[model samples]
Target: MTTGPSGSVLVLTNPDDVTTDLVLRILAERRVPVVRLDPGTDLHAGAALTAAYGTGGQRGTLRTASRELDLTLVRSVWTRRPSPFDGPPELDGQERRFAASQALWGVGGILASLSGAHYVNHPWNNRAAEYKPAQLATARHSGLSVPDTLITNDPRQAREFAALHAGAVVYKPLWNTPYAVDGRAQQVWVREVRPHEITAAVAACPHLFQATVEKAFDVRLTAVGNRLSAARIDSPDLDWRQRQSLMECTPIAVPDPVARAVCAYLTAFRLTFGAFDFAVTPAGDWYFLECNPNGQWAWQPGPITESIAHAIADQLQKGPEL
Candidate 1:
């Protein structure tokens, strides 16, 4: 498929994502060619794909429905979550697994090979930012205040750290794995832990223990291509995520140093966009918690949504600074 111009935004997402929908609407208003795709499902359904790379050049095409997207014309590729791969039904269990893996690496590699197309948050960068310990350490080094943290596999060390923090420590999951209890999806939230609460169960897997930040409120800062939108969130629960219904979100100015730190943290991770979670104290100090390289920002109220949409569109049009 030959595209008209070398200027198009290829969205790697689904129709269900309102965030991507909002951006697509904005791009449409600005009269930009957009090729939205759901790679996982489409790759197996009927979407035809052609990817190639050699000394000659690298290029590909992803065609779905009646439209075709020339991979070479893509200026930006939004790497949002799409439906999981469910291959052809005729394949047996092992065959299905093998096909799925091959397709993931084959087609997925092609998408990743779009070096000219700017990724909002590159896949490799996203994988690197998943390490919470590394994130905290980097944030600290970049002049951001971070809570005292401990990652341990030994039960004895966990208790000692809790003691060192005067039992003001909280336990959080090292990985936010989707879990279900009683047929209901469950999310692990940060909660205060007592020394006695630390037990042999912690030895089963690596657990993160940290000194709980004295929270006057929580801040969710979404940064897109040098633009930072900060929202002050006030909640009544120890874990604000658990009491989102009781939370209030409002736009606020990010402190100068904190803003610099946020930009530095993004630069450190080599990400064009990031959602930073910070704990604000009564003393007016900010403590960095973590940075989700490809975090969600659609639900953020006020001007944040429109501001981010424009930022994303402008970034795509301007191309990568790197």
Candidate 2:
């Protein structure tokens, strides 16, 4: 890709994203040139995207209905939850499948590989960080304590593992993507499990089983580049995300070791931003649960929202910190 003007930040997201809106607000105040693109919709619609290879990398331009973005001029990119590619309703099923693949790879690949662009948790890095097993292994490699986890497809072994953990095991999804069941949206929340709950259905697919962490409160640490801001969350439920209204969050100081470990994890996965979850025991132990490279932050219960917005805007404006 070719390098050109600076201070041009490209936001890749779906519509009605509050986090992106917050960053755009801050950017507007700073007079930064920004462009928003949703490839899932635009590429299949009237928009145009073109990329070409020269000597070094790729140079491209993406033109939406209202604006044209010079791919090489983008100094930073913030990718949020972009919707999946869905072809025109008239297309056949196989045709739609092919269109989805081309859109995902052809256009999406170039966007992911923008030259000289700083991504707040790049798409490739986000994909890797989303894997539960990869997160656990990376956390462990970073010297952080992770709860013992088992991804098994055996019903008897799952029961045995649950019994080994004194029945304090929690059932978690390896990937937390939501799907519709009977035309109703469904998501599997993390909940404590018993031996009897592991039935023959466990043989059909792999399930994530982990030893539960008995904790006083949860901590959500948002790391944007080198700036680490932590929020101590107290909730009555096993998963605070499900019981968000019943939770309280306060900005708190993170321990030095854990802070360093978080930074290392981001480096390990090549991410510029991360929302980390930790279970803090009463004894002051921080147990690493998972780190979402592109996790939510606008719904923070404390004043961390503005801080995060500022951090993201700064990161995108100034390019990533070395």
Candidate 3:
């Protein structure tokens, strides 16, 4: 698997992430020129400044002034999970300086320099994808079933929504804001909402209450490029993440229409990859919950991981046509 003409690709990521390792493995197996930007001292501001900023930002001017320097071009860059210094105390003042400089100069500057890079998922795109309400609208437009949802801070509206769903409503946070007080990972799950609970729920923060579908199985559909992989996650719990041991996840193929909807949602978000959560009823109804652009996929089984790696590498080596 030799890359004929595609030049080197610089993957901006931490050395520790399994996704990074998986991508690097794919590129290496294909004999693709891959440069890794890892954690720590490597992020120090030097070379780029020496080139982009050095000699008053002019290579031709330096030559005219009798200064020697070599000008090289960056073909492409892939900004994966950017690695920055961990603890502030672990790094010295200068090291901290380098990290700050890197954000503005190293990370920010390098990405600014490159004209185009096949971003598997760009930062701004990820930002847009995080909007759950927006994703819900997009999913509905793509012919996917979405549960009736009501988002408001009014207590009366909340009570009415719960009454409509007949106490079969679920209250969910718009975002996952987890904090560790001791060593415990306190997860917030969408629990069954009672009409009496609506008053407090509305007081929380613009409650996003939805009709809790009696799900036959929860589906986590991961889409990498045009390749789609589905997993049927069965758990007795409403939110499977709360009780991992009770859940069973098996790889499965999505229906053609459902697959198309997933791809359409990805396109709407301008994302190359997405992890979509769906609720399937006993009637075989697939309801769109949300799609996370930077969702976790490494924990998935080998086949899924391999396919994802292939999709990413194919896109990087070839083009979007892959």
lDDT of 1 by residue, 54-111 (tens): 8988778888887888888788878877665655667889898888787778767788
Q: Which runs in model 1 stand beyond 4 Å of their true positions? A: 1-5
Q: Which one wins by lDDT: 1 or 2?
A: 2
Runs in model 3 lying further than 4 Å from the true structure: 1-4, 38-77, 83-106, 109-113, 180-185, 319-322
Model 2, CA-based lDDT: 0.86
TM-score of each: 0.94, 0.93, 0.81
**Alpha carbon lDDT of each predicted model:** 0.83, 0.86, 0.72
- Single out the weakest 10-residue window by summed lDDT for candidate 1: 1-10
Better of 1 and 3 by TM-score: 1
Q: lDDT per residue, candidate 3, 128-166, as tens digits?
A: 889878988999998889999988888888888888876
Considering lDDT, which of the candidate structures 2 and 3 is the better prediction for this target? 2
Quick one: best TM-score, which candidate?
Answer: 1
Candidate 1 Cα lDDT to native: 0.83
